[model samples]
Target chain A: MTTDRAHSLKQLRRMLLVRRFEEKCAEVYQQQKIRGFLHLYIGEEAVAVGALAALRDDDAVVTTYREHGHALVRGISPDAVMAEMYGRATGCARGRGGSMHLFGAAQRFFGGYAIVGGGLPIAVGLALAEQMQATKRLVACFFGDGATEEGEYHESLNLASLWRLPVLFLCENNFYAMGTALARHAAVPDLCAIPRAHGIVSESVDGMDVVAVERAARAAADAIRETGKPRFLELQTYRFRAHSMYDADRYRDKAEIAEWKKRDPIELFVARLKAASVATDEDVAAIEREVSGEVERAALAADAAPLEPISDLERDVLAKVVP
Target chain B: MTRTTYREGIRTALRTALHDDPRVFLMGEDVGKYGGAYACSLGLLEDFGPERVRDTPLCESTFVGAGIGAALGGMRPIVEIMTVNFSLLALDQIVNNAATLRHMSAGQFAVPLVVRMATGAGRQLAAQHSHSLENWYAHVPGIKVLASGTVQDAHDFVLEALADPDPVIVFEHQYLYAMEGELELGPARASPWRASVRRAGADLSVITYGGSLPKALAAAEALEAEGIRAEVVDLRSLRPLDDETILASVRKTHRALIVDEGWRTGSLSGELATRIMEGAFYDLDGPIARVCSAEVPIPYAKHLEDEALPRVETIVARAKELVARRG
Candidate 1:
């Protein structure tokens, strides 16, 4: 296969993996295995798979609680991610940070900040560090449309722009801040305008399409690299699952949900691959099997992983005193 | 040895830290150009240049949170929050991010950030600008909270706090900024974790910190004139309360009077009183008494403000009463 074909195939495989992993998480949550505020990125897989594909290895990523997809794509081992959900010793955060706090320092994945708009300032700071160090590295900060209403969002944008820090503000506009629609929470639902008001370059993209997200992210990342300034991209997408396991999801209409499902990212991407002759039917079937197998193995490994010792409960609260 | 004002001591400490460590930088609103709201970072901006001394926008949360991020990225950052009242704007970043990041990240990162903010009421800065809220910060777990009561502590604790690999909050009492004292500053004379007995006595223990330290000492002196010797214990570190020093003092005096500027309701004084009750109940000759600010919002009127806050007269009176009640 050609290089482009291989890359497209890889994207398809990643999206499938995220979808299948989240499906397994949902299943196990009911089985009493994975617990505590599981936010599945079922419909928003394309944004993570696409945007992360544009980042360099040394570049940093700070994301929100709905960050399993971001973590997986940022090269964190799926087994470690799964183990973290199980609260095991081998987890990314050593079982201390459950679903909403996954961290992989080696990969420069800062955290899965549960607080809305909390990660924005941290991203600006990370970018400031790189700028001060005269490094070309940039930081990608991911938050929801709901975060636009937060003061940190505005503050972060202003600081990033004023300092000319290299940062990509990826606003994943899933249209709901946990059942409160954007219109109800924000004066202006067009999040792209919010960053523009802060004097940062801003744009909105079809977040459901992986190729579009990748293109927009690469352009934004490149612009930040060239100018050492911040850029904002509003990824317009939807969430297929309930906000968390506990949500009754009574806030939205079923008709709206069904309409969004018609443009399901994974299904649309598979059709695009086939139409473009990037992958045949047999190839697609093979990719599905591989992704399913990987998810199964990860689940099994997480289940077998050891629990952190109770005696070490106080570990990592403070940095260990170097003797 | 040089005599320095509390403000000068803080400025000297910042200068020393900047000169000592290449990784250290100062960022805050008006820190660089305006020379700091409390003038603690004056002249250093011109000395170090703009890159090391950054002047940020008037957005507290983002700037404070940025300090945390910069620390995580391997730079020692000293973020000034103007005053405790303004620090509230950044409380989310301080309490949620800086304090919790190390633990939440499971040791993947340590925020070596020092946040300096002027605290307490005395200049009649009104309800918005004045209030003692160090207790709120001390209530946190991950971050270390230090109250600089003297010129020596103001000069030294900044260095010690910067050396630590955790987030540390240094509360500079706004009232004590102009107070001058001789400091033999080279290395810090004491750890920021332990409490120091400012004055030693056997009759009563006057426990206090920050802006109340002088009042506590004055009360001790007044008691000395009255033939009642009172020990003055300055609680330099608020978070890890030096239970040893406190218990030792209580054991010696058999009477304790906590003088705190923070209000009586859910104050650090209350916590200290509880600690004394729990550990040295048998050692106590009388019930533990406390002179804290009134529960009402700190009024702007000087007399009302004086009444609201713990005064030297109140401290002396409370001490005398406690001593008399010691049976």
Candidate 2:
């Protein structure tokens, strides 16, 4: 509906929204309102914003614990997700899932699969169903590079290829897979090898560049749409923060963190947009203000949200009894 | 009147479900061209075509997890994991994903997944292939456990599982596949949700399920010859256990003898004994007793395997001993 410039601006705003929302989340987490493992998706915004921009809203998404940005970009209201993190009754998951287990069934945002590589098989299932139904929708399954250590990583890749299911396997290579670097964990740090080994068409993209990410995702999505097959993308990006709130920065070198920060996804995207005459400094400032307002309002609403009643403690164990 | 083997009972259910529902499909190792590992899904692939009656590449976890995923995505997926031993590989998917999805999503999503597997020991499959892990699945919340003990149940329970909105784990005892019985439909048969009294007696209640049902019934018959009439209760639905039927039978008989193929230590029989004790502590004529498999891996030798499992002789002897003892 919008021109390329307008679309580019929307993607930039989404990145800013993800950035600011998580920033507020980090702030809320300090107050202990958002308990549990708060995995802020502050740095790796482009990967979600750019990649999701290229896909249709009907397509399914199954991602890992670091999924706040994905959930936001995929149309889960920040207020609802924030309320979930706050353990509110009106949260998207009715306050049960917390931050790490956000679920949006209606949105086809299947989960916040906390287990490493656990989402892969679920993603394959979604794709399998879509393929069976002859739907053009593809599943964008996101996982960390550390997930390669799992047997399911190989199993899912093999199954997706064997069935030629419509799944865009997005491996957000954020360098560190929770304290252990991808190099330290994987024998062949080349993230694309396993998919290629499974005969999947694989490519790598600079996850820091929003336009580049959107372009690569569009191409891959198009290929899957036409071929009704699986594709893989190693979104080579970096998380500016620690894995979770509890993670001490003992694993990474300070210099390495700063080095990756030089290619900060948001900063790089802002510079790209400005250079291409898509936006001005004032426009960027306006988006920053708008994002800040949205995040602040979401945080306030989440703070005011009521905790779930104790009487409903054991709800949803089963949807309905067989009797 | 119709007759069917336990295997055919399951095949009929599969055929009926696939014929009726467009979203229903079956997938497992050798379910398609191989006609299932035990022939439970024989001729289904040919009837429904390969897309619906799918065969996997021996990757138990992915296929099971895929079923969980597909179930979440509006498809009724019945995933077969060859045996309970192989089902262990897919435990993460079953326990972590399927069981936790509804609770974790806080009632927003329901995983209408049906996972079927062959369980128990009899044909000398040895330790790796022979295990009764129904207690493991039944122990979890958000999942329904069904182990059909009769031909009607074996055929009908699959349809029941498909109708339910939550994940159901059906354990078709590999030993009972060839056992044949006449199908009894209509109001006489109870729903899959309740326990059925296979035989009614005024003396003591013999509670069992799956592979142990026939042995318990045979034991009850032998007791009848000795003038000690023992009631036989088949627990079709293991989870959300039909406590009313079991307790009523136990109260009427004033005695209960539990039989199960799982080991005595931390067994479903143990749970049943505790529940019976809790529910009917005062209405007992004798101390509650259980005849469980000996605490050892089922050996390949027929004699050793027979000794390890709950035989009719073991159940009869245990019931007689319990009947003789006074509370």
Candidate 3:
């Protein structure tokens, strides 16, 4: 197999893994194994897998609550991610942060910030640290189209632009914030314009195309590294699942969902690989089976993981006092 | 020993922090060009340059959240909010990110951020500018809240808060900027977490912090003149509550009066009173009392503002009432 074939195969594997992992999460959520606002990255897998593939090992990533894909693609262990969802002691965050707050310092995956636009400034600050330290490490900040309405989003963009911080602002434009659609929430629905207004380089990409997202992310990341200035990418994606377990998704039309599903990222990528002769039908089926097995193993490991001791509930509130 | 104003003490601490540590930087609105809102950071921008002393746009949540991120990214960021009221614009970052990040991340990260803000109602700054909302921050668990009342504290607490591993919020009393006192220059021996007994007496105990500390001391002086020796316990640290010192003072005095500039309902003073009732209830010869701000918005007028906040007269009166009820 060629190098391009290998990369395409890896990307397919990651996207498949995220899809199967989230599907398992939804199934378990129905069985009451994992609880509390479970926001799945069902249709938005390409945005996380493709965009995160462009980052350097030293670079940072700050993402929103719908971040299982981001965590998985950022190289956090599947067992740890599943254990966090299970609220187990062996989880990445030791079961403290649930589905909405996955964090891993070693991976430089800052957090799965639950607040709409809360992670933007944190990303800017991380980039600001890199700039101040005179390092080449960049930070990738991910948010939804809904975050554009937040003042922090505007403030973060202005600061990132003004300071010339090496930041890649990845706007996962999934069209809705919870139940409120972008048309209803934002005064200007064009999110790319908002970043461009802040004097930052901005572009919109087909988020459903994994190759397109990866190309855009790499270009944006390169631009930020070369110029030490922030760049923004509005990945036009969509969430196929309900906003959370509680959401009935009354706001969106079934027709619109069906229309978006026709452009399903994984199916599109699989077809592209097949047409390009990069992967065969057997190859795709094998990748799907492998990912399904991996996800099942993760779920089993998470279920077997022990609960964090209740006596340590007050631990880690502050840094341990060194004697 | 040098006599310095609270404003100068704060400036010295900031300057010292910047000079001593390479990782320390200041970022806030008007902190660079306009000095500080209360001139607490005057002349440091010219000395340290713009990078260390940053002047940010009028966006509180972003800058404060940036401070948290900077702290997480291995820099000590001292973010100054013009006043307690303006700090509310950044409350989400303060409460959600700064305060809860360490715990939520399960100790993977600790935000060593120092947030400074002017607090309390005096100088007639009106409701928007003058608010004693330290209690709101003190109610939080992860972050440590400090109230600097004396010139010595204003000089020392900033340095100590910067050294703290967790996020620390230092509430500087707005009215205390020009307050002059003898500050023994050098390393401070007092810990930021411990409550100090500024004036030791046995008749009654006046527990207070921040802008109300001076008023509590003045009340103690007045009680002294009335042959009632009142002990004054300055609660420098609000979050941890220094329950041992408070209980010790209450046990000695046998009477307690909590003076807080915040409203009576859900105030730090109420927390202090409850602690006393829990630990020193049998030791108390009389019921615990508190002199808190009136439950209305602090008015603009000088008289009304003075009447709304806890004052010397009210503290004196409350102290006397508590002491008289003793046996």
The lDDT values for all models are: 0.91, 0.90, 0.91
Error of 2 at A97 (Å): 0.4
lDDT of 2 by residue, A45-149 (tens): 989988998889799999999999999989999999889988998799988898889888778889989888888999999999999899999999999898987
Docking class of 3: medium
Q: What would the per-residue lDDT of candidate 1 be over residues A126-147, giving only the tens digit for each residue?
A: 8888888889999999999888
Pairs that collide, model 1: none
lDDT of 1 by residue, B6-93 (tens): 9999999999999998889999999998999999999998999999999999899999999988887778999998999999999999
DockQ of each: 0.63, 0.79, 0.68
* Index of the highest-DockQ prediction: 2
Regions of candidate 2 where Cα sits further than 4 Å from its true position: A1-3, B184-189
**In terms of DockQ, which candidate is stronger, 1 or 3?**
3
Which candidate do you rate higher for TM-score, 2 or 3? 3
Interface RMSD of 3: 2.0
Clashes of 1: 0
